[model samples]
Target: MHQTPSRARSASHARPLPWRGLALAVGAAAALILAGQARAQDSGEVTKSHGYNFFGELKYPADYAHFDYVNPDAPKGGEIALAAQGTFDSLNPYSRKGRAAVLSSTIYESLMDGNAPADEYGSMYCVLCESLEYDEGKTYVIFHMRDDVTFSDGTPLTAHDVVFTHNLFLEQGLPSYAIAVKKRITNAEALDDYTVRFDFADDISRRSLIDQVGSTPVFSQKWFEETGARLDEPRLETSPGSGPYTIEDFEVNRRIVYARNPDYWGKDLPVNIGRHNFDRIRVEYFADETAAFEAFKAGEYTFREEGNSRLWATSYDFPAAQRGYVVKEELPDGAPPSNSGFVFNLGREALKDKRVREALALAYNFEWTNESLQYGLFDQRNSFIQGTPLEATGAPSAEEKAFMETLPVEVPDEVMNGEVRMAHTSDSARLNDRRNLRTAMKLLDEAGWTVGADGKRRNANGELLTIEIPVNSSGAAVLESVIETFVQNMQLMGVDAKMEKVDPSQYTNRERDRDYDILFDAYRVFLGVGTGLRQVFGSAEAEFSLFNPAGLASPLVDAIIDKALETSTQADQDTSLRVLDRALRNEFFIVPAWYKANHWVAYWDMYSHPEEIAPYDLGYLDYWWYDAEKAEQLRAAGALR
Candidate 1:
């Protein structure tokens, strides 16, 4: 998953390509010569490239037409109504402040569009850029400006605008993006009126160079100067963008309406030929997902990607669903599974011991949860990169063993012997497995916790063993059940564990501040490795309060992640990733959770989509179109009222 600021953050909103990991061998001279020849053919003064792939070669040719996942002749006229989980206060997505609207990215266009095919991995196609140019070394990237591009305000897009946007993100964006740019990108310069070049630091990898440059969205320099708006503050005014849509109307914290740009410059581009098919995209924000579901059932929204497994299994028995006015579809998922579960905050002294953490993890009964709550629609996610070749399985290869030898700490024998220790206990029949409970109790006793006469375990200081879990409203239903079961098993082992369902905003703020004992969280691991991964397990990120939610800090883990990112060959990447996965699993910072294999979605009968969806995304915003005739038919039948 190659994350771009212009891309959406979740599956339910405007779809963005995952900022996946990259792997490719480089051949310098021949690559530079070919790029120069291609560019020379396009323009006399400079060479240009249409796109780049992180893997070996580009699948689509130089003169390729529209993407295969779209209907070229799809008509666009009607509107599509969608639902958002929480309230949105800001329109400026670059800032780390308020939650931006769901489809906010639709208004902005990037130098390259990251809508890639299944096999391409981290490939990015030219969108705002007519062509791209870079040496095989990947020290710098040159974007050949499309002369015909213009913002919604009718201002011409130029190299200066690109430079300005890059600087804004570097100075005042999310700490993750800011830190990445400051370290990887050296400078951005305008070569001419129609060309911009992004110079990369020598330490940057080939994959990181392309992803960072191509995914950057160019903002109008003139608009910012005139408005005098702070880039770090949340503003009501929509930033002028050159994408297919613009803010038609908006009511703060309620609903946002976007109208397609009649003067959109890139509509006919090969990358966007059949995309952005809706005339209007309206995103309605609700306080909670339950209210949003009820609104969806009442036809307040036209489409929904269901996240609740229980609702998908038994809740859709309404008149619209029974009458076939609404449709339900299950699409295959190709991306990696989420590592969501009860994560221990290592900042707490009580959870600092590996034995205690391991004992707590063993008490969670995922098998029972899958059978009762989820309808057996999920599988346990064991590794960080679940459902991928990068995942560590079976035993460590000779390469992985060699890498582990260099580390200061010894790799666990169970991991080295290819024995995977699942978080669940052995007994599938009982919620509180007595065998697993005894094991947990023995481990706790060894870790200096003894059961008191009151049946509560306590340390030498008489401090009870307690774990606090803070959860948001969206996860309340799913987590409440899991928490109840986990607490039951923990009580048998003389441990006190409780979960508090907090408001959405309170939960987000507490998470950002890193103020909790145990929290239900999920982290997505991509296919490739890079410095961006530091946010999850790196010691430096722990200090910055970024993605290291568990407060994990280990020299061995850092070294493994660094080695994986630094490796160039496919074989080397495989070895380093496995070693890292094995090392992290041994730590037991998070009690692994279950993940669904497919996307469960329901939509109104008034919409249509392309036959093939992008492997990494649903492509609803990009490929799905509103059928006005169908909408009228449903309206006449009083099914859509």
Candidate 2:
């Protein structure tokens, strides 16, 4: 399955302030003034900087079309390209799901961005909106846009664009659009050109507000009104946008060319002053990942970012590595790969019982699977969101302790009784699944689901336990095999469990529609904790129609989710999130899986990495310039590997 590389395209509107003091003068000036000269004269290669590096060949240049090297007037050019494994045609962030798609949407956007750190999973930074202001209760939020901000077309951006985008989230009836927008934002009114206020019927937080609002891409009022597009058919919608790069050219399943807008309004915004470095970004498409990789070896794309660990270790160093065209780079800061595991569809009817979920969690053997298919290339994880206040890190803060003690939310005996039952990524002391299975077995037995004569779990009604893992193989494949191994182990233990892989496109729909038992690798969440996990197991977000990926239902978990939303302070929010995490862990709702530290990447080295740690690869995109002379040197020496 040849795939097209993608980036996130948040459809929100935001603004940046005066950048005189931010030390962005050099970066901002470089992007605006010497962009062409920089691209034309870039040379030298340094492997490590802050925590991000890339050298993979671009397979799909059609969708991700580059015009910088060839012609600043022809199309925009980008340095990074992925050997996409499959054709996930959707590029719009609103419609896209997996990591590649989501990240690609960001690349194609001018709003929000994620940092590619030297040592972490990374966090998102705001681009368009200045700072989201949350009310004391967290229900209402105010977004203040910079007066000078303008769309890619050079039209001054206003609060109207922000309100318009949210309204579209409702009008288009985007799946998560309602959960993130409609439920809380009862009313949206632009105070003036620079300010927009959202009135929430209920309480929600501000940290979450910008993500919902600022993260969305803003459109030109003129373009939208002229197109008469209501987003009913996103495939056909071509509304104008205001970003560093505008769609100079785009073709479905072929290529997308973005040129740096000469008159880009927010070019010098405080948040985006140093980003969107490429003169243009060109993405070309291919049939499947295998062919795409072959093309990468042929220098068609950059190289490869093996999403599957087995392939990361095995597939590389093939005939291609013999040449100097490919090189495997180990991460100096953290593990070489990213987190991978199953996301139990809490929205499914089969996932309703907390014990059922815990019992299912025991079925997979992370240790065995790690040794078998993964070859110890990945780490396991119990928390849904990694590296955020929302993560269920052990040793609760003072506020969290009190919240857990008072809130009707019950912390399991494992959490409250002498032992803390903490979660660790790859604890040498204790294996990831070892502790998980113990809890799983205990939770199931306590829930009254007994092992049957046939060695399969049966409810009182005599129905055998079966888990339907919805799979399409869009991004990661580790979970599918993990689920299979788990099912086999469960059978040996007198339990009936099996892995069911389905179409990737239909998997989310089936899970979202509340139509599946257990969807293996349900989603690769977009942001760290910025994206509220309320819909997955949240009472309201548990519906198939809503944002509920996991169909878990519990009054206790729901209350904690609500309480978490009620606070506006980051410190208190962290405390609330911890309270919510411990409460859900006690319920045994989600069968925590594995976590990958970084994208296990192997690419042809060319471009120079940052001098220090670049906060994120995309965040510092503007700071990166291709070295033509060095690129030619590597090309001649075959040092690209």
Candidate 3:
């Protein structure tokens, strides 16, 4: 699933996008859909299934007890406290007006819930839906809603609310989503109080139609009308939802607590049996990581997901660790690494040239940064889909070249025949490598940015070649230091480069406004690419979509993405994705950075998890249970407050 975009190391509380891996399962209905009229005429009926998987077989059967990765008998009832960097003013996560609190979407539930395993790609089981009906042609889908579901306000959740929520998003949601949804779905009608149907548009690809409608977050229609809530406005008054958690209490910019609903409607459902174990999930806000780490050392929070390599390597020798009150470990992370780096804002005129972007990328030394500042704990990210089979490797195959030949935009020979692009390597012992500096200077000079008498680069118009990386005050100290070193290197190349530090609120607004020349942001990496790519790389949305931080709009990229989404087989998809990766790397929009293959986590000794964690997620907030006896021991030892 595509995670929400965020600054360096900032945790996003927003829910994952629903339509991530919703392609039709291999060999399940492929022939039925591919044969079209012939298959539909032979079998003139739709099938009702308890779950859906677009790419592979469902792991759990209809009558299965629970997921193998979860502890169905896990105990419940204790609080888990984590830290949030930066302040928030709004409780409404749907709007674009204000910064929403972390985990603000915990109170919301979608029509279907996804499986926990990364290997079980695109599998979704019914939650609010008892079963969904779709034909072999896949032109339409009918959701048979469960009658017993209720909102947190004790109101019935029906098909009408689903239709209402979809329509509301169409009118007031993010522009990219609204535009994409309108083109795919032709009509959404409530057939009855307990049944809803969505008809698809004939012009678009039907691969992700079922997933698009199924993942819509269902909200309380009555709550919206009665409370006069606007989905586009910043407001503290939240509409009621049907999820397992509710807003328990809050203090703006200080802390927010979400308590488990004792009377939640779907608590006992098979899909939810082993999840939502915490009685309370509290988030404490801090200005930066330094303060948050000190608070964690003092027992202010119970869990910490360490993102700073320096701290993870050198710190953790506090009294709590010596007393055996905290447990620190590195857990396996099988998911693809995030495509994070210094993204050049294409909206800026100075960065419109590819040569200039490549020059800037050459200036940042990832080798030195990884070894000197990050403790050699990370690997240089080379592709958008790094470490995955879909990642383009050596020279493209003959089939890949043949496929690129048909694209409207010309694929560069370097991309079609050459090895996959990799970040430039430098000496780990020095921040400024003379060879890379000379290359960057030559590239800049050739691009019309020549060094002036004052030893600063300027264009033919005499405008200084300035680059600014706006960062929030809450960014990790090690990361800030890395940026400072990069700025120093850029300065050595006769480019005017500096880090602009701002408060969290201003940083948020500036990022939204696309006010910086270069910004450090991470793009969500997808296991199986889908229509969600439109929001991230499509030319139509690149100008305004917040997800497209670099404002990258390229005709070649748009064409490659379209080709990738139109594939029907896994092999075809992989070929198209390899081509797409080649196309994006050729653009050089982001200067590649470093990523770790595991999750670094530390927590108080009072919590426990299942022996085996799912490959995709840690499930700390979902399945991990609290230990009452261990908590009492910690309290007795005066290790916790």
Candidate 3 per-residue lDDT, tens place, 1-641, comes to: 32222212226322243324533233444342221111233466765676665543466666766777788989989999999998999988877788888888768776777434333557777889988878866789899999999999899999999999989988888777788788888899999999999998885666667877887788899988998888888889888889999999999999999999999999888888888999999999998999999999999999998889998998999989878999998888656777899999999888999989988887889889898899999999989888877788889988789878878887888987898888899988889998998998999999999999999999989999999998899878898999999999999999999998999989988988999999998776765657777778878888888888998898888887777766767677778878888778888899989999987889999999887766667678877899999999999999986
> Model 1, clash count?
11
Q: Which candidate order results from sorting by lDDT in descending order?
A: 3, 1, 2
Candidate 2: tens digits of C-alpha lDDT, residues 247-347: 66656655555567777765554344334556655555565445666677777666354556776777777654676556675433212112234556654
* TM-score quality measure for candidate 2: 0.71
Structural similarity to truth (TM-score) of each candidate: 0.91, 0.71, 0.95
Off by over 4 Å in 1: 1-8, 20-48, 117-119, 402-426, 474-476
For lDDT, candidate 2 versus 3, the one ahead is 3
* Residues 1-641 of candidate 1: C-alpha lDDT, one tens digit per residue: 33344212443555554444354222332342223234322233433467775433555667778777678898977888888776677787666566666677667777887554433555567888888877656677888888999999999999989998888877767776677567878889999978999888885455466766677777889999888887777778877899999999988878999999989998898888778898998888787777888999999988888877888888898889999999999988776766787888999998999899888877887887777877777788888877777778777888888877776666567766675554554566667777778888999999999999999999999999998777777543766777878877887889987777787667767887778888878665656766656666778766554466788888878878766766766678767877777778877889888888887889999988877666677777777888888889999999877
**Ranking of predictions according to TM-score:** 3, 1, 2
* lDDT score, candidate 1: 0.75
